[model samples]
Target chain A: MKWQIISSDQALYFHSWDNECVVYNSLSGDTHLLNLTASQILLKLQQSPTEAITLAKLVPPTDQSESHAEHELQIEHLLAELNALNLIEKCQSTINYNPPSCR
Target chain B: MNISTLTLSELGHRLKKAGMFLQTGTFITHLKTSIPSVAEGIRLLYADYPLVEHLDFADFHVSLTYPRNLRRWLKPQIQFLFDGKPPFKPLPADQAFPMLEWGLNWCVSSHANHYLIIHAAVIEKGGYAAVLPAPPGSGKSTLCAALVNRGWRLLSDELALIHIGDGRIVPLPRPISLKNQSIDIIQSYEPDAVISRKISDTMKGTVAHMKPPANSIIRANETAHAGWVIFPKYQSSVPAQLKKLSRSRAFIRIADNAFNYSLLGIKGFETLTGLVDASQCYDFTYSSLENAIETFSALEPPASSK
Candidate 1:
């Protein structure tokens, strides 16, 4: 399944200090504090939709980062969490950029 | 003209009839009430606030009066009316004064969208302001009272009104509300501090208000840049300490403390981002007011926050 930031007219804002990032979703009127991995995944998804495996490849590995399989698992966890927060949406493979998973 | 200039008789006469136009900071409120406690509380606490004479407009037209029900006789209650319509369920008659204070706060936070209002106590010194955002019983008001008694200028005790345009703190120096043990603590801490008669058994439990420092009231129009965003917590016998806070974490905490952050939408996010960017954030835990005062006094605004 592909993932993308939930499309909204309102903009998303990010502010970081000491590597901690807080994302404000103007669309949902919600604010979330994200760790580096989660923030990086969301930032990549925000640019455009991509499947879980491709998203892991897009984010560079960190010093204490887990292995590739574990990285994909973390991405899946983050994507599910973000989607539940109304910050991102799940897209199907053959989609014309449309959300079919619990849209 | 200040409220002190009007005798209690004249103040009552106006309040009963045309209502009094009182100005706090830039907002002018047309206040009407025949409730003696409300009148007396205003007389005692708002003596320094300006009485807007010859004004054609007021920001909020509010009144505290009795509900025309049986409770008005048995366990009588007071209702807050804005523009002649009651917005809150009637509170106990004895809570009239605090009801008025809370009502005024509601007025600003509910309708004053021009500002990015936060649920914080802001005090200023040396041209910089510290925004204290803490939940109830966190000693924010107690610390605010102590700081005001010292050299700090009181911007606000309950609301931190941040100017959206320039990100400066617009002063709303009203009476500081102290609850429970805090009342006696402040009285002992500053014997000269003018506090209202303690009213007990309300929503907040034995509450009283401390008059803002005269110097703070006189300097109400002066807006200061936010230099510190400190979340203060009070515990018994704990020594005062300030720990650095990440700006992103500070953003989330302060946003959670805001009254209309979500209502302001993008403006709230942008304005708060600017505020956090220019502020040195900290988590301050203290027990002794003296030590807290000394610690706060020693703080210099972040040199680069500007």
Candidate 2:
């Protein structure tokens, strides 16, 4: 999975691990972990206005046959939790949801 | 006597309407603002608070103007315009533009009577406050922003006001300001955080304000006894570490960060010395908020026998 560098300078790189649905910042010599689900939803949202499958595509399947429905439901629950945390912002327009400004 | 006495709802309406209100124990200010957007912004920021009239310390009233000229020359006018009895120093004639309003509030109203203010971040749990005093570019704001987003109650993100007399911390609980990368770091960490519009092209790069946590606002007037004074420096890759600092060394370090230490003369020294006697001092170097938070959470009061 590729990690996107959202913010970085000479000493620190804040990146999102799309595969793990986590955000981490590497600085000086330490790596800090951010909320997992929030990181995932944000990356998914960044890709496009993803529905359930779009998120599941980023993660591995628990079971071949049930992966589709299970992942969809999980994404729904994840989105709710993220919303409560103010991580995945809501948008009025159907087209896109621009993330809030950095810091 | 303090404006904080007002309920959040009252403060919201008065600031939006550009009305006059009381503050602190003295001084009166009348605000006059025409910008509807700025009006709404102020309203939302003071949401649920009573009008500024509730402040007890000052009797001053201010009227703010919208699209308001945020010029540097207005500092002195603002200082004089919000004057009180028995005479106060006139506002300095020269200053910088789009100057931070709440930052000034922390300097003037903090409970500390002796020490000058240090631009820094503070978070307290169990009465101990970690004071992150860093010059700009030290990643202090970024680390402070992340910690407060998690669970720490923000004492402040820009000003650490230490009381000189008893060494207690005066709670100013103002909004947190983030610039450039920090803004993004916070959004990634906690999406729901309420942030203000970005004001661009400033000397410190782009800037925006984070609404202080709701609970902090309610307790803004509450003061905390200084427990541990931890000066944090955030370097990206280092493991979290805390080192004890001698009281004499702490005094020197704190004085370097102070805003008006020289102005207060002996009172400032006495106030700082008293604070040192009451608190434990340390230097916290870290790249991990988790370790930092855990270390802070596990701190035993200096009085605890171990």
Candidate 3:
């Protein structure tokens, strides 16, 4: 319902639609559609103060009943991949999402 | 006259009236049109540049002739004049005349004696030239037309004449050719801009020519240092963005886009390489002309003493 916009030299808006996660560059008309787990991790990071731990906590729960643990692992896995892609930064175990500015 | 003789005779007659010679290797078409609009188009397109001098006689004369097409279609034994110089193989009579005429004009007059001719739109500001080279439908012409009207000097909107000796961009200052929607787009965007009458039903689709900036026309022979080699793509609703391109990659891309690079061989390669080394390259995409103008005006060329 709430659209969280993260702005720096460039701005990236994060939103969820039909449970799909979407990341879009507001300036260049470039859009990236993310999977449910990845989007959730990014969304959780928007508010999470403890970047690494919060990402670990946002993973999908291990079981339908153990939803919390499953969610935590899913979030950690997605964060690791996004971090590898250089789309996010981990500062002293805290992760930050940054987008490109003009060239 | 035989068909071969007819081609020569027709070319000679038209060149005489046009007050320009049909070089031995060149081919030209002679068109007699009563349309004042067509004559206006010629003046708008070629009036300023010394290389594109217009004849005072008729309303206008259009010539189409080429060399490579001749060599491909005819054997080496055939003789033809190129630039009024030596004898070269002639192109087949069946080939398209308009393209050849345009191509020969490109090959002979352009300062790129060593490099292949690039079909591009170039504009100058701040002592450097912005080379806008793109495929059809890429809006290069639209951006060029807009810039020329906005006080940037028009280097060229169709051919970039890169000087082979010094690696500088030789100013052509020719008319800007607008196709399809760009004609109206430019007119509406720049109401004060002077544009020629639109000629419809041409092979390249509905086309119009925009007058070169007065300053550009006056200093047609002045050259600018290579500044930016920008490849532009226009898309609706997209904001302007310039992406840096690698020099090696840019060289290959530009060479691929050139019309006569291979014809000039090693000279072409060296000229393009020198240009790439001296200039910055980018991939620019934008839908709004306003945003494009702002982005270009703000661009800071790399800091280096010339």
What global local distance difference test value does model 3 have?
Answer: 0.61
lDDT, model 2, position B293: 67
Candidate 3: tens digits of C-alpha lDDT, residues B1-306: 112223334434534355342211112323332223333344344444333224344222333334344454454221223334323334333322323334444444443345346878888888888888889899998998888777788877777778778877776555567788899999999997777666565557776667666677667667888888999999999899999876656776787678766566556666776777778889999999999999999878756616
Task: State TM-scores per candidate.
Answer: 0.93, 0.58, 0.55
Q: Report iRMS (Å) of candidate 1.
A: 1.0
For each candidate, how many residue pairs have backbone atoms clashing (under 3 Å)? 0, 66, 31
Sort candidate 1 into its docking category. Answer: medium
Model 1: how large is the Cα RMSD against the reference?
2.7
lDDT of each: 0.89, 0.56, 0.61
Question: Interface RMSD (C-alpha) of each candidate?
Answer: 1.0, 19.2, 17.8
Query: CAPRI verdict on model 2?
Result: incorrect
Models ranked on lDDT: 1, 3, 2
What tens-digit string does per-residue lDDT give for candidate 2 at A25-99? Answer: 222232233445445556556554555566677754545676577777876776666545434444433345533
Of 1 and 2, the candidate ranking higher by DockQ = 1
Q: Write the per-residue lDDT of candidate 3 for residues A1-103, one digit (tens) a residue.
A: 1112243334455544445544544444334557666676666655533355555554554356755656665666666676654445454322454322200
lDDT of 1 at A39: 86
What is the alpha-carbon RMSD of candidate 3 to the true structure?
A: 15.6
Candidates 2 and 3, the one with greater DockQ: 3
B1-306 per-residue lDDT for model 1 (tens digits): 688998888888889888888889888999988988888888899999877786899999999999999987788999999999998999999899999999999999999999999999999988999999999999999999999999889999999999898899999999999999999999999999999999999889999999998888889899999899999999898899999888888999999999999899888988999899989999999999999999998897788865
